[model samples]
Target: MSTKPQFGADIETHHTRFDVDRYEDIYVVGDVHGSLDALKRLISRLELNNDDLVIFVGDLVRKGPDSPGVVDFVRADPCLVSVRGNNEQKILRGDKDPDWLREGDREYFESLPIAISFDTVLVVHGGVDPERSLEDHATDELLTMRSPHGDGYDGPFWYDDYDGPHRVFFGHTVHDRPVEREHAVGLDTGCVYGGELTAYDYRNDEFRTVASKTHQDRASSKVVDPA
Candidate 1:
């Protein structure tokens, strides 16, 4: 494991690379959005073992109840890791601050990577910059980007244009279901909006989802103002 750091907008962008074995049961989860109960249920369904590793695509906080509980849960677990999401970046950039975050929780958020690479799969909160290589990708873009525009093509999502040697597993843009392209996958199924929290198991090439336990009215309001 090794990390490269880049600073943008007063936040540090940490990128990590991992060399994972083929047999390892690696799982990538979509945006959690502070749905701790849903997250727990989703994890339980995985039946994870000592060898299994789970990586969250981010937005672990904000827009649901028990943001602190989510942070604390992941923090205490060694097998879980996260990439920085737009929501996490927002808090870092001073857009909003919830009372749930503890001092250590803030540090944990700051330490999260902008991207995580394992084997041939790259995990990020948002889609990548098509114009730049992974190493040169901008930190802000990694956290907040939804789509990329280029060469008179005015209206297509980022995954539509992706031609990659590495399979990208990302979360950010909400879709009716998990969007799957040849080279990329969009896993943000709007878990905070009374939708399901999803997870992909790379080893088995499977997807698992747990339906939201939150009320739509309350969840919608929290999506706008997480504080």
Candidate 2:
């Protein structure tokens, strides 16, 4: 692993890009939220290989038990990549740092990219701006955005207005089920709230989900917060 400085709000100026053609299978996962057991079960089902790429939509910590375990598991393998989520940004921004996070964890989170592009798919922790190109996307919108409209602009979900050719796969907004739109797909099935942990196979356009085995008491909290 490379040692990089812990970035602050200016982290958006640095981004990482990857070429999908370099891997055989590319799997994108939704908000993990520290459900290590669920994530393990889901990975077991995938039967991943050396050439496979597992990209997490982030929120790897907070709101659930075993956050450190999740971080360790992902960091142990080079095939796994995670985009920074709002919860991660909160931690990186010194908003919330759980006891589980240890030394060097901040650097790891700071080094994470805001979004990842693979072929025609763009994976992010949150939805992107419909009006801006991926390279010009605002870091705030990519990390914390929920609905599509803002500032008194009423409209449909962000994906509904997406006219880009690249399909956007994201997490952040929890749904009872995965939300599928024309150019976007939401996989944050609220795993931290006792919902399913979802993963999308970009190679086959298929989805796999593992029901939450822990934190069932938090199920009711999965509902979207009122705007």
Candidate 3:
């Protein structure tokens, strides 16, 4: 488990990593995007033990039905934790809160760290810059980065050239399937847009996914290059 000083008011502040251990299995999940039913089904399939931990890459709200429900489920469950995604940041920083937001949801989002760390892996909502030390990464890159070159819709991606100290598991960029690289594993399968809700079992190195019901039909296809 992580110590205190996990979440900070400033993004540039280095986040405290969860040095988690003693779990039967560690499941790293992609963006749920408020697909609560799909998330439930995926959890049911895992048959997780009490000690088994699930770390979500974030985007637990917006773009689908049941955003409030998704937040409530994760908040109630002790085994589940998450990083803060761009969507969550939007809600916290926006002038207007969404109607679906309930009491205590903001605190939950605020509690999420920018990254979760295992001995050899790091989990973030979006990609990290391989060229910089983890402590030096900016908040915007950790939340919304897609291309390594710039915020463009074309390659090469952030992980394409990574030769890492720790393998990074991330989401935010939707792919038809998980992106597998030596140093990066992308699990955002676009669940809100009719793709599968995906999760990676870290101990087993296996992917557990469930078919998702489409809530938003626009841009439902795989993102080869960003759109």
Residues 15-53, candidate 2, lDDT per residue (tens digit)? 555677888889999988889999999999888999999
- For lDDT, the strongest prediction is 3
Alpha-carbon runs more than 4 Å astray in model 2:
1-13, 151-155, 214-227
TM for candidate 2 is 0.85
Error of 3 at 161 (Å): 1.0
Number of clashes found in candidate 2: 0
TM-score of each: 0.85, 0.85, 0.89
Predictions in order: lDDT: 0.77, 0.78, 0.83
Clashes of each: 0, 0, 0
Query: What lDDT score is found at residue 200 in candidate 3?
Result: 94
Cα lDDT over the full model 1: 0.77
Worst 10 residues of 3 by lDDT: 1-10
- Looking at model 3, residue 194 earns an lDDT score of 91
Which has the greatest TM-score? 3
lDDT of 1 by residue, 1-227 (tens): 32332334333336676668743698899988889999899989999887888999999989888788888888888889999998988888888888876787777788998878786788889877665666566777777666665312133667777787678899877765787777888788778888889998887888899998653343332222111
lDDT of model number 3: 0.83
Displacement of residue 211 (Cα, Å) in model 3 is: 0.5
